[model samples]
Target: WTEHADKKGRVFYWNPASRHSSWQHPLTPSHKALVAAYRRIMQEEDRLAAIQSELEAFQQQVEEEVKGWRQSHAPDGTPYFYKIGTQNTRWDNPRDELMAHMDLRMKMLQELSQMPSLLEEVAPPADVTGLDRTQDSAGLSEAAALTDGPGSPVAP
Candidate 1:
């Protein structure tokens, strides 16, 4: 920051990098305000760090609690999780919905793999154009068979 004088000869501070001009000197009460603001920012950073530490500790506690659940398979080959300490048991797997979706996708893929790659449904007959068509007994070309009359009335 540098000091400059306006056309009227009044002392003004100018910051070339920020293109800012101030009538007050830099070392005045603005220095105290800057120091107070710096203190506030440091306090906020410390508070956020404390909050993050608490969240991490809470996450660790949850992970440790989840580790107590034991997985076992039923006689019919179905899986379940049991937490003996908490007397909690569930027949359905926690990831059952996602696994069921993946199972359906796999089944569809297997069925598609068994089909012929070039398989196609039956196509309609080729259209008979005006060329190489003999006039019918009604004196109408084969291409004129598209008439709205009954039974097409082409007479073969």
Candidate 2:
């Protein structure tokens, strides 16, 4: 393998038969399958992390909204001021809807945290052991088929 960089950018060259090539080739079928599984796990991890972060932000929103409401309302929980002509209430109502949404999101975060450990269900259980980790066997088998050598579908 060889690498050359010009004013444009960097580049790499490789010969299939060369030992200790400069560039490694793409994954084989079995390797690809393993990679896919690993990707799935990583994607789930990212999603769960995002959810947790969002939940934290939403909590902050809830706090700010509640604080504003408390500040506008009187000590007795009544409106401290109203518009001169119109019956404009002063105190802001508690954000029941946002609170509810936050609650639901918290539940979703819990489920997402548990997702990686949970396995996929395929068939009826004999002893009810729960979801089977062996459910991804077909994908693994498909990837293993790539070992058939060059010109095979898995070769590239």
TM-score of each: 0.29, 0.32
Candidate 1: regions farther than 4 A off: 1-45, 93-156
Best by lDDT: 1
lDDT, candidate 2, 1-156, per-residue tens: 245444666454443322223332322332453344344545553655555665576578667655543324667875443333445444333354346555655565556557754433335546333222333645542223333434344434
What lDDT is reached at residue 104 by model 1? 44
Candidate 2: clashing pairs of residues: 29-143, 30-143
Query: Which 10 successive residues of model 1 have the least lDDT summed?
Result: 94-103
Q: What are the clash counts of all predictions, listed in order?
A: 0, 2
Q: Report residue 59 deviation for candidate 1 (angstroms).
A: 1.5
Clashing pairs in 1: none
How does each model score on lDDT? 0.53, 0.47
The top-ranked prediction according to TM-score is 2
Model 1, backbone clash pairs (residues 3+ apart or across chains), number: 0
For model 2, the local distance difference test gives 0.47
